[model samples]
Target: VLVIAIIAGAAYYMVAVQPFQRVILSVGDDSVKTGYFLKRMVASQGMTADSVLQSLTAELIIRQQAAAMGFPAVTAQDISDYLRNIAKGENETISDADYDKWFQERLDTTGLTAQEFNKVIEGEILAQNVQDTIGAQVNPQVPQAHVWIIVLDTQENAVSAKARIDGGESFDAVAKEVSLDTTSKENGGDMGWQVPELFSTQISSVIDTLDIGKCSDPVAFSQQDSTTGTTATSYLLLMVSEKSAAMQATDAQLSQLKYKAFLDWLSAQEASTEIVFHGLNGS
Candidate 1:
């Protein structure tokens, strides 16, 4: 009877363990590899190999965090909303089944029960709430500016160009004739309503110091060519067309603000956490 029991156990491992192991291995090496990669993450130079057990623990922690923050638990509706937001953000069509299949595979690999996974989701939602709170504190009604930008290849060239403009040459004609940014040159360098953050520090500072309809001295900025990773020097000539007064936050805008604030907060939290890793295989 003992021998028979041993044989049964061996069979169980053969039928279950091997397949699961292969799935986990394949996921680590290929497309469905979130679980595998997660395990490989090191905390302070130590290995934290992904395991169903770790996932379960993480989920529990997330739940505790949520509860502590007075956030509601995650629900099916929450998941649906999250999925919709993801689809909109990615500009892709994804179905509920897609989310379910992806998460179910993750849960299977991480050994997290559905309830445990929900807890993790709940924690995430709660964390988002904290982010929302921070975002609400930001003054989203900050004014946007309509301006023109003249990009150049060098600082000397930008300075020369600015000299010409200040000497009474037409900004539009000079920009069209000399500016390297062909797209904007044709429009007389008009870059429509943009927030201060969108411009480089030099350009933003210059714009802040100028009145509307005032042209700035050529301010140096850097641009990277995405294809070749080449760094190019550029100059901006800004003309602030309009500046609006601060306005109240819209719900959609508030959500975006909150999301960004949350990310900043999360980064800070992660930086502060005491984390350590050991036995990093590759390292």
Candidate 2:
């Protein structure tokens, strides 16, 4: 009986403990064990394993690359303050007892030790710092277009609208009469001055080639219906009223540019870095 029990213990260790301790990711000399990966997987419930792994890889890369780039240091106090603010909630004050209870409950829910959770928070803070540092480098000025659009439910409607505009009917009058886009239809389809990047991929591709003071060929725009989960295609007739080679971007546009710059930098880092995955297939 004792021999059987000893055998069972050994088997459990080999089957469970060994796999958890196995290295699934290696970046330079640093490694991520299956246990660590599993914890992240649990925290990011509903995401595919590959996506979670990619995010984990990006987080690791951010830490390493940001350090290399001399990004600002994140102190233990910073993490503590973040946690404290969370515990404080909407009201201003929080007592020691309240914080302790909230912290313990969070740990219990996430199934992560205090140190492990703190490490996660640290990674997040570091990633934000990296984004800010890289984002600041984006230029505030960009080529922009002053544009107007008329959206219609059908291609025939778009063609008819174009004909009306071409046949001496005011673009604004036609747009307000037949356009389906509520946001801009009331305002004579005026989208205001904007960079191409602010638009969708499909729209951005054609915006650059459109001649000023002329309407574009009906551009197809596909949209997914939220209630029915069905995709619907719409047609857009666009006119560029004016163009500027170097317009100063708005505050919001500058913010978006900065974010794009940061993402571009991160993508470059991920592309150059060689990461090895071991025992990651089954999970």
User: In candidate 1, how many Å is residue 20 off?
Assistant: 17
Candidate 1 yields a Cα-based lDDT of: 0.61
Across 1-283, the per-residue lDDT of candidate 2 in tens digits comes to 9999999999999898878888888765567889888988887766677887888888889889978988777889999888899889897989989999998988887788999989888999999888888777877889899989999999998998999998888888988999999999999999899899878878987788888888888999998997676999999999998989899999999999888888889889878888888866323
Candidate 1 is scored at a TM of: 0.55
Model 1, position 217, has a per-residue lDDT of 74
Error (Å) of candidate 2 at residue 59 is 0.6
Report the C-alpha displacement of residue 125, candidate 1, in angstroms.
4.3
Q: What TM-score fits each model?
A: 0.55, 0.83
- Give the per-residue Cα lDDT of candidate 2 at 95: 94
- The TM-score that candidate 2 achieves is 0.83
Model 1: per-residue lDDT, tens digit, 215-279?
Answer: 78767677789767699767777778777656445566555556666656655544554322322
